[model samples]
Target: MVTVNEAKQKIIANTEVLTSMSMKPSESLNYVLFQDVRASISLPSFRQSSMDGYAVHDSDITARGTVLEILAEAKAGEGTMQVLPPGAAMRIFTGAPVPEGATAVIMQERTTRTGSFVTIEDFPVTPGRNIRSIGQQIMKGSIALPQNILLTAGAIGFLSGLNVEEVSVYRKPKIGLLVTGDELVQNGSSIRHGQVYESNSLMLRAALQQEGVTDVEVLYAKDDLRATIDALDELAGRNDIVLASGGISVGDYDFVGEALQSIRAETIFYKVRQKPGKPLLFARRKQTLFFALPGNPASSLVCYYEYVLPAIRKMSGRSDYFLRSVSMPIERGYSFDGERDEFLKATANQDVVIPLDGQESFALRSFAIANAIIYLTVNQNKVEAGDHVEVHLLPA
Candidate 1:
């Protein structure tokens, strides 16, 4: 068995960022940019009016109540390249291009209009007032967004404004999940004696979806070694990552480890010195990564959050892939002397964290309400009421 740190390092050393693909910026939300995105053209490529007012030169408005003749009207999206005659004003609306020699746009509310003329009010009109200058937002041929930034909705709109059609971004990975155990029965089915409703598949699928991974393939396998081997082989052949829940521990019915070996997959690590998920397994077959979690629902989920999720994040081009952990005081005293490290499901605030009851490997009630996982190291098991401890915050 390897230490938790060693296991994590091994996973990191083996994982690589996936290849980049060209996708439309609108469809690239949550995907990390593989390269810097440069602006194709300067935003607002022309002098634009920012208000529904008159476009005029500095001399057009010499004093309050100065009346100027309206040469022509310019609406949004219409050309206004014609020069404004001397001492004349052009009726302009928001987003309309400004005519040549026009230095300012007086808002309509601050002016009174007569027949074919507008009278400037007492409001001071300065040069370039209410005008959007060319390239006001972004300059042409400059880097609009840096590499490795996650694209949000606002970023997508910004890219569209810059006329960027497609972007190079790291693609999300395709995952394959294989659930094992014959004692487990599907939900909505008749439960016979000694049979329990299966929930790991749905739980794991929802977890994967939360990470923006939707292209998942799911399969079920019995305790038979051959069935397990076949299911794993099929999943590994079609996915970038393969996950198997159950049949990892050394038991008469456990066959996940044997099946992986039978397929000639390289075992990166067999177990970690941790409670609830000590029998976790990580391996690789060619380019596809594999993880076999314990059959217990809570242990399976804990392993997924700690190990599998990080691997997915790395593969999807995230640099900060590990869970966010911080040290905080415990709300109450707790004592445990187990040889393996323990991860207790807990709810945490900014000041302190409270470890919830029902932390057993199969319990899920506490995990359901947990927002954080309080990590207790193997050797340092005793914790005082106010002692600071490491807490890993779960993604909301």
Candidate 2:
């Protein structure tokens, strides 16, 4: 077994960012941009009215109660141009194009209309008032968004507004899941004396979906070595990342290790010195990455969050690939003398972190509600109330 830090280092050293692909901005949510996105045309291409008001030259409004004739009206999306004569106003609505020869816009609330004329109450209307100048948001031919930025909903909308149809982004990874166990049965099936519900696939699949990974295929294998090897071969052939749960430990029925050997995969690390997830395995075959996680639900999830998730993020060209760590005060004191490092499920906020109950590998009652994981090394097993500890926040 290797140290936790050693395992992480090996995984990072072997990982490489995936190639970039061109895709429509509408379908590129949560993807990292591979290149700078430039604006082809200035935003708001024309001088626009910011409110429902009258458009007029600044000199036209001479007095507070000056009455001016209301020329042709200009509504939003009006293609034809209307010229505002001197000493006259043009009726304009919000987002409407400012009529020719008009320099100011007075909101409708500050004026009263009678027939074809309007009286202005607010005096000394400033030039360019309530008018959005061309390219006020972004200039044409300029970088609208920088490279390496994560695309959110707001980003997508902004790009769409700029008329950007497609963008280059890091490719999203496709994963394959292989589950190994003869005693595991799918949920809703009747359980025999030694059988248990198989929940790792569903739980792990959901976790992957939260990371914006939707292309995943799941397969099951029995305890037999040949079946395990065949399943591993099939999954590794078509996926960028292969995930296997169970059959990693030194048990009699375990066959994942032997299966990997049969496929001639290069093992990066076999295990880590960590509680709840010591039997973790990471390997590589050419460009594909593989992780064999422990069978227990809680242990499997912990490994996924700590190791597999970061790999996926890195492959997708994200710089913030690891779990965010914060040092905060503990709510209660705890003591443990475990031989390996321990990752305890906990709930935390900006102020404090509280380690929860039922921390066993097989128990998930606490893990289900946990938003963070409190890390405790073997040498620092004992903690006191109000002591500061390292906590890793989970992804939402």
Candidate 3:
């Protein structure tokens, strides 16, 4: 068995990012930036007032009880720009463009206004103190945002302020899911005595969606070598990635390996030094990719998030899109199977993440309240309280 580092390397080597696509900024939510954006015009474009106050020249705000004559009123989005003369002030509201030749703003509360004259209570107000200068937030021709930044709400807001209504980003890759089992039954149908719930496919679909995948199709195949092969052949190359669960182990009904080999899909890696997901397999053909995951619900979800999501992010044009978990302190010092790296179910509260019920893979209730997976490598499972561990959050 190879170490976790080897497995990670194998996974990274098989990844290839997809091409870029054009999209409206409105539809660009969750899309990755393809290129760095530079500002064309200065943010604000003109000096403006930041508060509801009076815009005045430098000489108008000097000495105690200095009096100034009001020239004109400056509303937020006024008609034409004007120049304020010396010893003159303009009644300006919030966000109003600061008239030319004016450098400071005094709040209405700090000055007494009567008729056309105003008296300053606080003398010697600092010039340009409350004015938002042109290009202050963002300069013309300056880098607005770097490439590969995820299109979040704040990023979208920045783009909107810059009047950019469209952008180029990498689209999400489509994936097809194939589940194979003879003892499995869909939830809607009545189950026979020997049958069990078929939940792995649904879990994997949800996990992929949580990773920002938009297109997914699921199909089930009866546990027969020929039938599984036929199903896979039907779905070949129709998806950017194919996720197959079950039929990877050395069982009588296992046939995914045989089918992949027959299809001539290049096998990059198979098996990893991890519990419950040690039977993972990865393959590629042309631009189409495939992954064979375990059938158990928890195992299926864990494996897909750990390996498949990274591949999806890379394909989405995000350079640093890998899942990063917070290194939260653990609650206890405990022992685990020292054979492979374990991603035990865990729950995070405040700053500490606690490991929940630890049971066999097939037991679904063990993960009822789990929000994260605590990482523990083989041969070093014991951890003291406050010792930080990597945590992968589950998609709710």
Scored by lDDT, the top model is: 2
Clashing pairs in 1: none
Off by over 4 Å in 1: 51-54, 58-74, 79-93, 106-126, 385-387
Candidate 3: residue pairs that collide: none
Q: Relative to the unseen true structure, what is the C-alpha lDDT of residue 72 in candidate 1, on a scale of 0 to 100?
A: 94
Model 2 scores worst on lDDT over the 10 consecutive residues at 333-342
| Model 2, CA-based lDDT | 0.93
- RMSD of every candidate to native, in Å, equals 2.9, 1.8, 2.4
TM-score computed on alpha carbons, candidate 1: 0.88
Model 2 C-alpha lDDT per residue in residues 168-257, reported as the tens digit of each score: 999989999999999999999999999999999999999999989999999999999999999999999999999999999999999998
Worst 10-residue lDDT window for candidate 3 reads: 317-326
lDDT of each: 0.91, 0.93, 0.81
Residue 66 alpha-carbon offset, candidate 3, angstroms: 2.6
Question: For model 3, how does the per-residue alpha-carbon lDDT over 94-172 read when each residue is reduced to its tens digit?
Answer: 8889998988998888889889988878677888878999999999899888888889888888888998867878878
State each candidate's clash count. Answer: 0, 0, 0
Off by over 4 Å in 2: none
lDDT comparing candidate 1 with the true structure: 0.91
